[model samples]
Target: MIACLRLFSALCLAALLAACASSPSSSLGELPRTPDATIEQLLEQATSAKTPEHAALLRLSAADMAFQQNNPARSAQILAQVPLDSLKPAAQIFASTLTAELAMGRNQPKAALAALSHPSLQNLKELPPEQQIRTGTVHARAYEADGQTLAAARERVAMAPLLTGDAAASNHEAIWSLIAAVPGEQLQASGNPVLDGWITLAQAIKNAGTLEQQQAAIDTWRAQNPAHPAAVQLPTPLTRLKELASQPLNKIALLLPQQGPLASVAKALREGFMAAHYQAQQAGQKPPVIEVYDSSRVSSLDEFYKKAQADGVQLVIGPLEKPLVKQLSARPQLPITTLALNYSEGDQAPAQLFQFGLAAEDEAREVSRRARADGLHRAAAMVPKGEWGERVLKAFRQDWEANGGTLIGVEYVDQPVALAQQIADLFKLRQSEGRAKSLQSTVGADVAAQPSRRQDIEFIFLAVTPQQAQQIKPTLNFQYAGDVPVYATSHVFSASGDKNQYNDMNGIMFCETPWLLNTTDPLRNQVTAQWPQANGSLGRLYAMGVDAYRLAPRLGQLKALPDTRIDGLSGNLGMSPSQRIERQMPWAKFVSGQIERLPDTPR
Candidate 1:
């Protein structure tokens, strides 16, 4: 089988070289022919081979060729013809591995596992190192297809030490991707010190914003696990971290409406930012100096920004209102980097400006994503009767449809009667009533009738306040639409810690920050103890402030690597190419008058 594979690879290289030479200057329509024809010719030659061993080798080669042609079914069919009993010991193992791979390609994980279950193929350590890694990779993939993420991750981890050079890098990347897909709680519970160490290192790298912090994390991991494989592979990520951490920014200026109608909100944000700063200080890390500026007292943003620049402020964070964010974003040339607290109205934002906020649109988009992930593809939206409701509904609809979900209906109403009427209309309850009325009129007085809700809608997207949600939820149950699951934004729940008030909201699911649901965290407990009065939107804003403080120095690194995510108090933060940072939050469901956190899943 090894000789046959080498021969096949040589033939492919020759064919590729010939094609490239023939099409050196060919036009779009005059390119060289595809290798499918060559593959077919080889298949015919394999069928007519004289020797049995040659025939088996030819069949295996044809199966590999078919796979290269992107025809897994054809490959499996070809592999089925290879006489496994006639091949040598090594050849038999290779043939079985190839068969299993082809079966996996066909999405038949059980068949793949069965192919690898032979006694001769069970002891992979006896095989060559490369073959062992290859076999282990296929097994891991099969496990993943079977929905066994931890098992799959462990399979890769077990093969890690044997990999070297480029293969080692590739294997490490694959392992990280697999582990990253696993939930944090599951990763922590994996009981494998190597996997746990990798997860911890990944989190530390994500949260680190400076070279010293990253080096300290790496050193700490090395100290804890001196012989671990990840300790040796730390240089790869550290190179990128050093590059990002090299950028200089020693001073930051915060602009907030400190003495106006929004003073309480500004105060909460200040406290949150300070909490993060203080935490860094406690960790023996010296962060940049932060100066607070009152936006309400400033005559103009231009003057304030110019003053900050003159004062040698390397970064500016703030202007909590939308108008101020818009005004600052419209500036042609900002002397210093500014992180706006709110997003501008238009899609295009100025350079040197990054927007971060507890935007309703962000939560609405997340609701749609979570709904689709939960297998709810068809949704009916119930929003309040106002601009805010319309905005949230629009965001949900756009994201839902973009993700291949069907928006069955959208209704906006504030009053309970209006909400009930909209729900009835959405579920076609009036049509059921009409049918019942017709049946009653046509039949005698002793007839009975039953009304049914629409079955097409899989879930509901609600954008309403806590009070409105309480009224709407019970009305949905009363209207015979209780079976359909309902998903909402964070607006449906208040952070007042009153479980009894939300008893009516049973079975409703929403997404929110860990700071609200995970009260056991030291930071959360401290924040709650410090500000007992913060609730609902104010609490969310405070959490956002904490994340903002942590994100400031890491923006450069985030832009450098778009796939990297920071676990924040607000949510999991990821950066977009357009400089928009999105938060992926934990999910929660209202059950028995109390909020319960849902298991985190891949987004």
Candidate 2:
């Protein structure tokens, strides 16, 4: 694990090297030109500097070198010694940018943004183009980390004129990535011609009917805006898209169990996949011919693949059972590209096998991301007492700690009768009561003292059922923890449309599928019109099924371009290295017996 982390850190430093242009020699101020100087030599020079400004410059250079060497701790230590308010404007900007970079390394994007906002940055343009590019790139990265996609794209767009050669080419690709990441609804005309042109180009490709039509749209966009930077040289993803257009998926086989414990699940998935297929047909786009195979009836996996290949199946989109997926994952290779509907336990997956699922782990990780984004660093958890809960807690802990959050307390929730005591124990309310008694005894009389829960807990990470959540929320209020924020997984919501039920869950924020939240989604509306149960908790499975269909043709697109995301009913979907599909869900809170969708940042 340590070796893997070292490899990851090395890759990260290599990626950031493009933005690490050398500091202008003029900022060094009479210091010997020792471009090859070690960190010790730089700090030694700083200690003997005659002027404070020169000392700050030396420290800044040392910090930059430390960061380049992947020693963020040493970089942060050196940066802390440089008194920013006492430094010259140029040195101040240099220090501030370096500070931002270090903060970002710590997963504190808000802190990074604050560092970059130093007043000294107003004179950034006066610095050399290298410094400007370095500063702008860091600023863009901070915005991206903070979930301000438009701001990040705009920053990159502003840096375009100042960039050239490999730097310019890289920034051009980055700008498109940031813009493409923006949801279709948020991709608006910013009224800046250059940014607006790029926005329109993304919208044109997104809204185009077919791959051929998308290629045509790109060609037309370039023709209409010949002066646009993207027109001069298309982003690499677009170049890949042009190649994908000629080789379309011609046929698909959806492998699922027709009769088993998961038959009902298979039904929902099939309906959802067909719903998307019919939608494409209705929209005048020619979707590939689809064949459904009942895996439960198949005697052999080899025979199944032999039939599929004989039938000219280019893509296989299921085997919703975990055991079946595990079987496929153990193979050296698959005869056809398979998008498994469920994920297996281990990381070893064949090159042709891609896993996608509606795993609760995704929601747990989403809670961590949202909680940290809300500035809640200290967390307590309440999850059901079972293996499912263990999995969720594991996912949350891994992501939460990795993002610099502290999980201070946890309670394995069991019976409803035990909830009040569990809540009290989690909040240290019993200790508070014990302290109150001690105070009364010391005073030798009755003293008025209200029990106070631990103030260290900033929020609660909750993973429970709808009924359990209904009981848990009011129990927390009874235990004096109602005021503390609660970040919950989607399990807490049943989509029952019961105002009284929702009122019980009031003040609890949860991540949920866009299908349940977006009442007006055309596909969702149509699907629910036919299968009303799609309006309930079952809707998430249906949404996952819809995403599976959307993912089938674009799997190659996603594999080739690692950053590509498909906004689907389930979530904002991306691919992991193991070919598992990861979802970033939208968040919503219960307010006044209604579910209120929230902005990416905390309210």
Clashing pairs in 1: none
- Tell me each candidate's TM-score: 0.64, 0.67
**Model 1's TM-score against the true structure:** 0.64
lDDT per residue for candidate 1 within 1-603, as digits (tens), equals 999999999999999777544233222111112244466676787679797766666676677777777888788787788777766555566677887888887788878878777665655565557767878888888888877777787888889889889877887776766655554444464678887777776666555655568667767877887877777665444555666566656889988897878898889888899888888888898788888898989887778978998888988888787888888777776778788887887767777888888778888988887887777789889888888888888898899997789998988877776877888999999999898888878885645767799899999998788898888889899999987898888888887667776788999999888778777777766777888754455777778888989998887666544556788888888876667788888899999978889988565
Q: 1-603 in candidate 2: lDDT tens per residue?
A: 999999999999876653333333344322212357889999999999998877877888888899989999999898899898887677888888888888888888899899999987888876777778888998999999999999999999988999879988899989988888776778888989999999999888778755677789999999999999999999988888888888889999999999989999999999999999999899998899999899889889899999999999999998888888989999999988899999899899899999999989999999998988877899999998889989999999999998789999999989889898889989889999999899889989998888998889999999999999999999989889899999999999999999999999999999999999999999999999999999998999889889999998888677644556788899998888788999999999999899999996431
Off by over 4 Å in 2: 1-168, 183-196, 203-216, 245-247, 258-264, 275-285, 294-307, 323-337, 344-354, 365-380, 394-408, 415-417, 427-461, 466-543, 550-603
Give, for candidate 2, the lowest lDDT window spanning 10 residues.
Answer: 25-34
Backbone clash total, candidate 1: 0
lDDT for each candidate structure: 0.77, 0.88
In the order shown, the candidates' Cα RMSDs to the true structure are 10.2, 11.0
Candidate 1, residue 442: the lDDT equals 81
Instruction: State the RMSD for candidate 1.
Output: 10.2
Alpha-carbon shift of residue 589 in model 2 (angstroms): 9.5
